[model samples]
Target: MSKKLIAIASTGGHYVQLSRIMKQANFDSNDILYVRTKVNANDTPSFENESLIEDVSRDTLIRSPIIAFQMLKLILKHKPKWIITTGAMPGLISIVIGRLLLRKTMWVDSIANTKQLSASGRIAKKIAHKTLTQWPDLVGENVQYKGRVI
Candidate 1:
């Protein structure tokens, strides 16, 4: 069976950046899957396999457990070999689950976060197998500024 690649784009810009990487890498919808909010799913109709989750942020951290449950279900169902995301709560949960499952995980920090890594990305840097920053200056021991999504 082909290994599945998972990505969560919680914001509009994050979705666009993920889309760019999908196209740049010539990944078909079948080769990869998406986890996003309902609005983000509506924004990008190309990917057929998508899991829509409740959007949560640092301000709305109270909903993390619910979001985490949803992430767990996706991980159990898809069994993705690779997990990736742009900074956000649901994305953070996915990468954490991915790491626990021994899946290769990557966090591509948003280009909008030029000064520092996004909050979710910062957390993912500790758990994810690889964390990448869009800006060169923000590279750290755990987070690396390799290439950009946009």
Candidate 2:
């Protein structure tokens, strides 16, 4: 079957959170395309269908264009119907490109953002098909308080 979902996140906590959700999501392995930030030479993929993008953040604006290009390429190659993230910057970028491709997108704000949504998450609320916060207190009209990854 063609992969229908592009599941993305940055490294560390974001990646861990996304991984946890994917494990419980019960999506067929063949229908999922996982994406994560490329961290190091040891960054071997855990899933059969996975891609890595250079790690970039707001502080690294110069690198964003590169990431955008990468996201576009991946979106074109995978042609996923849905894009989901437990994000930092890369995942957020993926959602933007995926949305431009008319793909459905979901953003799960990191559990670490207990006080507020991450910068990327805040933007995602405006564009993503669904935006979820781990903390119930953070939920509002556009953001939902789904159970957390942690």
Span of ten consecutive residues with least summed lDDT in model 2: 39-48
The segments of candidate 1 whose C-alpha lies over 4 angstroms from its true place after superposition are 1-3, 40-47
Best by lDDT: 2
> With candidate 2 superimposed using the best TM-score fit, by how many Å does residue 11's alpha carbon deviate from the native?
1.2
lDDT scores of the candidates, listed in order: 0.80, 0.89
Instruction: List the candidates' TM-scores in order.
Output: 0.88, 0.94
lDDT of 2 by residue, 1-150 (tens): 357998999888888899899899988888888889888967777767988888899899789989999889888887889999999989888888888899999999998898989999999999999999999999987999869778
User: What is the per-residue lDDT of model 1 for residues 29-111, given as tens digits with 9 covering 90 to 100?
Assistant: 78677777656535554446776788888898999888888888777777788988876778888888788778898888889
lDDT of 2 at 88: 90
Model 1 worst lDDT window (10 residues): 38-47
Residue pairs clashing in model 1 are: none
